[model samples]
Target: MALDTGMKCIKYLLFIFNLLFVISGCVLIIVGAVIEANYRTYLDFISSSYLSAPSILIAVGVLIFVVGFFGCCGAVKENHCMVVTFVVLLFMIFIVQLGVGIASYILSNDVERFLHENMLKSMRNYDRSRPGVIKTWDVIQHDHACCGTNNYEDWTSTPYGEEYNGVPDACCKEHVSGCGRNIFNFSQKLNDINKEGCFDKLKGDVEENVTILGGIAIGIGFVQLIGIAFACCLAKSLKRQYETV
Candidate 1:
């Protein structure tokens, strides 16, 4: 009688786990579908600097849902075959995610390098004579230009032709040459450039997030596999008990 009671308890637990797994899986699937559908929109948002982080979260959410569903079904059926299948699926997902994350990191690094190199070249070739280019240069320079003032001398004190002490007039000249404008104007332009870059970075972050989500889904799937194993053991034990009775 005690053996029968234990079997009944084990069955009930398996049933509960299966139901929960199914529900979670469904939710994940829905979430993944939504994210997949809006992937372009999310990328656009990153491009616009409106949002950071994308696709990864959605992908992970989807995986979680699918794996959970499989786990639930396996538990309900007490089928070791399904449980093993789910485990294999999870392992594959994990491997794929690891590959993607590494690839993305490499790609982003390459892109950053390219952008930095090109921007440097563009700055060097910039035509200061062109009004638009000059204006743009001035905006960029003023914002990023840095100068240090000596404690012993006041920069504002040198009015008109008064010889400025400590600080070199060449400093201002360098700033003007680099940005093609005064610091104040350059600062504003720099801000605009930074805003655009921020958006691009956010998009990259979204892809990274997808990889992270995949890792997490893999973990959850692993746990579900353990649960399925436990369920199988319980089912076998119950069967043995019933046979003895």
Candidate 2:
């Protein structure tokens, strides 16, 4: 009777853990979606492949939801096969996530250089189209309170820069009415032009966020230990109970 009671306690405890796992997965999906949406402009500016991170988060979240369901069933039914499968799958995912988190942490540290390089290349292509590229730059500059990838000097080398002879109106301070004139020589508007670049600001923010995310992933990966131990114990207890009967 004591053993049966202990087994029941383990089963319910595993159920609660798996339930929380499912909830965590859902939270990850929402977080990924929010990040992707917030950075869509940057994604559009850079390689589309940059989107894989958020997409993977959503995919992993769904996978966790499914796995948690299996574990929940196994705990509820005290089925040895279900519990074993759950333990194996959960451990595999935990290992995979640990590796992914570590790699992300290391790679995120140096990603800013790559962002700067790619952003410079993307800037040259900015004026290739009229409204398309123009709007992206305008929106990026306006929203970020930044001028160029590096600074206003970035525009000076471009063909469009030669024709326009000045920075975009988006670079002007909020209070400035019209920054249409030759901003470089215009001493009055010089004070209004935002010399700060978007890449530095954006990259710094992203790096901080990535570090936080990597830490979170590593922390969550360790949580699988609880599921694995509980599932294994519950399976063994169930097996023993069946044999003794």
Candidate 3:
């Protein structure tokens, strides 16, 4: 027996939902990749665990494509089994996405303390011969156009800061060899050096990015719920049709 008009509409709606799922999957993949890249730049200031959220997002995104295809096929073939499987898989993805959203929010709140402590520890390593340490600090200082963790004064406690008599050369507003030497106080050479601290700058940027990630995850999760509903209704219709046959 053919489906009633309402059932026919539900079938088409399920197909539309599956298409939306595929598009959202692409969006998640892009979001995950971009956030992961941003996190790498600040790896020195963050814990390695932070990377897992984005990595999972990418994985979930890939799984969505496969599950969405199954949903599409189920809706087209009017197969109760396939539609039910799609609903289960989508629910699993929804749970994962929700978890990621919550984790990102918690991480965002803890970022300030985490960055302050880690940045200070990393600053002490600046004077060492480690190229990675040197480059990380220099990149942060130069790229952000800021000085030490809290201020240029924060560097004075470090050997490199004492050796330079002020802050690292990367803290100079204009890149001049030895320009940062002997420069102390904002009044000494107001235009010559960056008196602002890197902590505040980095903290603000990181929090904003993390918040965006959380929003995306939660947003996608809610949309998945709708797709799950549509799939379930269609599965019910198919089951009833089979009973009458």
Best by lDDT: 3
lDDT of the candidates, in the order given: 0.46, 0.79, 0.83
TM-score per candidate, chains pooled: 0.40, 0.82, 0.78
Candidate whose TM-score is highest: 2
- Stretches of model 3 off by over 4 angstroms after superposition: 27-45, 50-54, 125-136, 162-166, 181-191
Candidate 2's residue-wise lDDT over 1-245, tens digit each?
Answer: 12577788899999999999889879878987987788555555655576687888788888888888889888877777888888988998989878878988999967898788877776666664645456777788888889889888888776656667777788877735447447756667668788888887789887888888788778878878877888888989878877888
Quote model 3's TM-score.
0.78
lDDT of 3 by residue, 152-177 (tens): 88888888877876778899999888
Each candidate's clash count? 11, 0, 0
